[model samples]
Target: MSFTNNIFLLMEKSLKKYGNNVHYSVLKEEVLNWINLKDGGIYIDCTCGPGGHSKYLLSSGKEIFIIGLDKDEKMLEIAKENLKGLKNFKLIKGGFENIKEILEKEKIDKVDGFLFDLGFSTPQIKDGQRGFSFREDGPLDMRYDITSNLTAYHILNKWSRRDLVFIFKNYGEIKNCERIVDKIIERRKKKKFETTEELANFICENFKERKKIHPATRFFLALRIATNDELNCLKKGLENSIPFLKKGGRILVISFNSLEDRIVKNFFRKTECIRILTKKPILPTKEEIEVNPLSRSAKLRVGEKNGK
Candidate 1:
């Protein structure tokens, strides 16, 4: 076997041992039901992290073809391994925002369905080096694509107090954002924030509040969103995809955050060529949450293109 194959083998072993920590596809039944594929058709897994959904769709007995896209190359590699022996699919290194360009490059004019699961994979959170979680101590780098210039470290250390405050309030929706920003500014004056633990500790120590969630949760979320520019990407991706969907084709989005859900909701509502399929977003079942705790916050919304 080649070195790359060896690496994939190791990844496969690790997943079997540790239980695919990348992500658990939430609302699998609902997604499959809502998508309602019949016969052979081209489907796109826009955020095909580790190929969980793609695998599910491929095994559904339909002669379907999938085009999987993701910004993270490492995740894409794992997805390739996870989806090995699947002959009817193509994996590409790109974000969903480039859907139009990707379709053009593939020489595909239209698709049957699109799925966007907008959540960080469990592996991403568990990998301390990625710095997505405060529970683990690691560098403050939270870019999904490491090649991206902006990172959690840059936002925490370099951004101005005003900008930090804006990020906390707008992106994180934290109530006491001003106080958190003040504390961050005070600490950075002495020594620049470097690690995830450093910033998380600062927030928890200074912000003495009794809450259901961690004090650093909102801060971390804000930094991640800003680092990735996720909202704008989602907006552009959704808008660009409408033109590519075949008549009666569906677009399903599983969003973990309310902000992202709202974006999907509003886009579907306003788009003339598309009709909203789900009046209220679908939530994961109690049983699914029991099996995959990370899936508890997931909300799925769907839309279908109208024949014109």
Candidate 2:
């Protein structure tokens, strides 16, 4: 097996041994009470990361069957293990963008509630080979689905400086995109950047300085987003999912960044079929933040299909 495959194996073994941490889903958001799921109705976990939400409500949702969809098959395999010892649960290796097809395959008419936890699962970030974190020594690849050939490596090495600037400015929210672009191009000309550490070091040494955050944060974010086509995937998923939901079905999404949250909020408000459950997004409390450091950046929003 290749080094990448080895990394995946090590990550799985560690997470399984440690029994991977549990995470909260949108159902726990304070603004979430507005959208209530019926006990006997079906629920969909569109992005079932680590299966914490399902574990919490499984007994309560005993009457409900859950169908979890994800683009990453490795993660889906882990999800199957996490959801083991439970009936009325199914896992599919596919993108949420194919929600209608998944529903069709299940032969289910309409789901009562659909759940989306948009955060990258912890294991993905923790794995050294995935190269999501600056701490890890790994390839620049950041696609959640390794099977999807395109990756951060391709973009950094091949994209025009104009595209780099565009991604940094629009996706990374980083200022001085032009300078960043110039630096990336010049550095790549000397040598093709392959590893996360190599690119991160070049940005640190040659790029403009930032006291608030790492200089490469935005560029990395942009590369990952571009490689995964995340925004479009989310939009497609939502558009396809709502149609398969029962009239009164609910859609709950938890997003980590402003861009993602804004998309979810605006889509819910503008959607004709959805009654916005959270006119404003719900945020984690100070207490919640203290417990889970990642919760600090989280924002939860929900909407219900407008019928009974």
Give the worst 10-residue stretch by lDDT in candidate 1: 2-11
Local lDDT at 275 for model 1 = 86
| lDDT digits (tens) for residues 1-308 of candidate 1 | 54333434554555567774556778888999999786779999999888889999998888999999998888889899988887799999898988999999999998999999996886787688999988769999998998889989888888998898888888888767787788778888899998999988898788864456667777888899999999999999999998889999999999988889889989998899888889998998887866665676799999989984
The lDDT per prediction is 0.85, 0.75
* Superposition-based RMSD of candidate 1 using all C-alpha atoms, in angstroms: 6.7
Q: Where is model 1 more than 4 Å wrong at Cα? A: 1-17, 20-22
Q: Model 2 over residues 1-308: C-alpha lDDT tens digits?
A: 54333444655565566654433343354523534657787888888766766655565534677777777776777777777888888877778888888789879877788888885877677776897766567998998878889889999999898888887787787777787688778878989998988988887787764545666666677888888888888888888888788887888888887778888987887788888877777788876754455566787788888854
Off by over 4 Å in 2: 1-35, 209-211
lDDT of 1 at 38: 63
RMSD of each: 6.7, 5.9
Clashes of each: 2, 0
